[model samples]
Target: MRLRFLAFLLLASGFGLSSASQEDSPRIGDPYFHSSGAWGQDFRDQWAFDAIGLSDPYVVWDALGESPSPVIVAVIDTGIDWNHLDLSWGSLWTNDNEIIGNGIDDDGNGYVDDRIGWDFLAGTNQPWDYDGHGTFTSGLIAAEVNNGIGMTGLNPYARIMVLKAVNNFGRTRTAYVTDAIRYAVDNGARVINLSLGGPSALELETAALDYAAQNDVLVVVAAGNEGQDLADYAFVNHPAVITVAAIGRNGERSTYSNWGPQVSIAAPGEDILSLRARATDTLMNITDAYKPGSAIVGPDKRYYRATGTSFAAPFVTGGASLLWSRNPSLTANQVRQALLQSAKDIGASGVDQFTGHGALDIGAAFAADPNASIVAEISSVHVVQSTDGPAAEIIGTATSDRLEIYRVEIGQGETPSSWKPVAQGRSSVTNAALATVSASEFAGASVWTIRLIVNRTGGTSQVTLYRLSLG
Candidate 1:
């Protein structure tokens, strides 16, 4: 199968800067729209961070205090500009096992002198981003934070393991990705971000996903940019993968984002500003590369703006890294559950086709109880759209050995303080309908909240919240 980088090029801007080899290397900072007070003094173009409850990461950081252990996130794409100014030495992964430049496979891992990362296409050590896709994805996951630099990544503690699987033209073969997946897992990667996808599913790639899961490595993939239901897409629906969809800044699914039952979560993907690989003309030749403004390269030639599910996957990869950094004992499935449970639910009543469990919530994921499965829980809740009317059926699992009653309630607003019960005093059922919510009930309100109250046999209880939206 032929895989492609799942992105829609929009804009590329930068003040022509010299190469990294130069003595007086140029300094890169936030975008002009951000730093010049064009949007606002405090505003920056990285709205995805805030959308996922990462505006202030101190909630997770303050608890860890000082240095958080770095989690290796493998970016399998068109390589990365490892020398990007905003990406420091500390942010990228280094392979201590492989000795560099001696012309021998010191580590005996099949590759010679693979110190930093391997380039599968060239079969060399230098995995430079000739197409700029991997560099952009890497920045979203592990760009240096709070040095007054370009952009802030979701996880400051993410050490990017640059794996070049795709070529300059943004295409990769099945064998390349399959090998990259194994290499990443063997090289100590906790999370693998696959920002590329294809139409057909190959056996090798299918096994690769299983290999990652077997090794307890989390795989996050982009739900391709085709904007169609991915029910027939076998690659994304794989049990081991957490497929991510792209949503705009307004919290609605992006027009180009593919959707299906397989969609694990959604993240901000429209006009997302990130690092641009030097000497790469990814968006330069595009038809409307500068729709909002004319091409102006300036103060920061390092920034690139684009949209797609490709950009959205890293936000989740970064979030997974943060969770691992906080508590290394978290299983890949546990981390996946934490992400789903802590997500800021949007669209439909619950785990809908568009947003899945909901949007990525890094802050909540960090604070989420890692051992949540042991207690009374609400595994999932989703809207079953009715064929008859505006009313939809709410169905999901709320089960535990110590369960007593589970109540479903609805309230107005994003985070409602008051909730009125819609379905109450019901016994636990493995897979059964909970309640029915009509659009007419909450007239004039577009946003509402669905509260799942799981009261155990004892006084102990567990409360879970899901966001509901209607036209």
Candidate 2:
């Protein structure tokens, strides 16, 4: 049997909808008759969710199957209640190195016993949502699909690394945020989503975002809800960040969503339906903000309908992860740029400060040139100094047309241009094509700079050195 979508709109400062009940949730057609389809699939919701593209990739059936490599999207927000009925399973990210409840820093990455993602808000391992915001964003990003319930996330199998940088009271210090971003990067997060924003242009935050860019991690940040131009907003202005603005069902800028040139793209942000845990909204549950009559509640978990740029950012984040996961060769920049370029321009034709490149379009992203010869990552750069000799190893991966990997450069200086290769080596296909160089490759001990030069498109390929930092 087909189920109708139970979406909602914000009627007040908290979770709400009119007097609508679960029974009153709207559907466009007659009651759905069963199709010989896979589990956990929702065709109706896909149409509602695709404020970006008209076509639904998930309807392709094969797209519902698990990918070989699921990308991890770090949701750095209030935290996530992954244990919620709709969100507790599937590719929700867990720290593989961490052991749960042992009370020890098993992985030795500082935070202890963080089996699931870390909670920087309380400095604990369990990132259970203290507020409902993260869970809502998490569902929009990846709420597990084909399992047969609720709404399907943008990317069905993409993992969510729950990082709670914001407190229950809706406050965050820059230090916590900086550490959270670094933690997400170091712990194998391919995409990071920041659903919270403020007016502050802090130095450390900018530096942390820069660090993420250097490490080849994509960051999707939310424009604030003050409904003003955000050209001066540090996070949105940063070249590394994909700043998102909220659009409504009518394909217009959200009244409460911030706008301007800094906005990278627009996405559905009004009355979005997502998973919400009653435990997190105890105070809001009693007030008019809580729409009990309309609440789709049962056994600890209920669905919420809310609006903000907070919800819009995750659509782009999930899109980026889905695209990158499908083609492991695309560089972080390539994935970000290609997705931006594929957007369906809205508002005043072409790009504008209000919508940037316009609304997100996920289905169009599949048309990206898979053999575009992308150098995806530099996983590690390590130096081992022993009694025999001193050596450095550079390990990274590349895509299809990559001819070979040669030249590992390390330079220490204030100037970025003044760097040279220490050693040259060949590459072979591992999972993706991997290049290896070590032992006697060391140029200097105080190496502050690391560069990997990959040659694509034959000798006609110009030496594009992928620059990174050991510091």
Estimated TM-score for each candidate: 0.76, 0.67
lDDT of 2: 0.63
TM-score for candidate 1, residues paired by index: 0.76
Which candidate has the top score in lDDT?
1
List runs of model 2 lying over 4 Å from the truth.
1-47, 59-67, 282-301, 370-471
Write the residue-wise lDDT of candidate 1 on 8-47 in tens digits.
Answer: 7542343233222111112333332123222222234666
What's model 2's lDDT at 24?
Answer: 17
Candidate 1 residue-wise lDDT at 437: 70
Per-residue lDDT tens digits for candidate 2, residues 2-26, read: 1111112453332221221232114
Q: Pull out the clashing pairs in model 1.
A: 14-297, 14-298, 14-301, 15-298
Give the whole-model CA lDDT for all candidates, comma-separated: 0.74, 0.63
Stretch of 10 with least lDDT, candidate 2: 30-39
* Candidate 1 global CA lDDT score: 0.74
What C-alpha root-mean-square deviation, in Å, does candidate 1 show against the real structure? 7.6
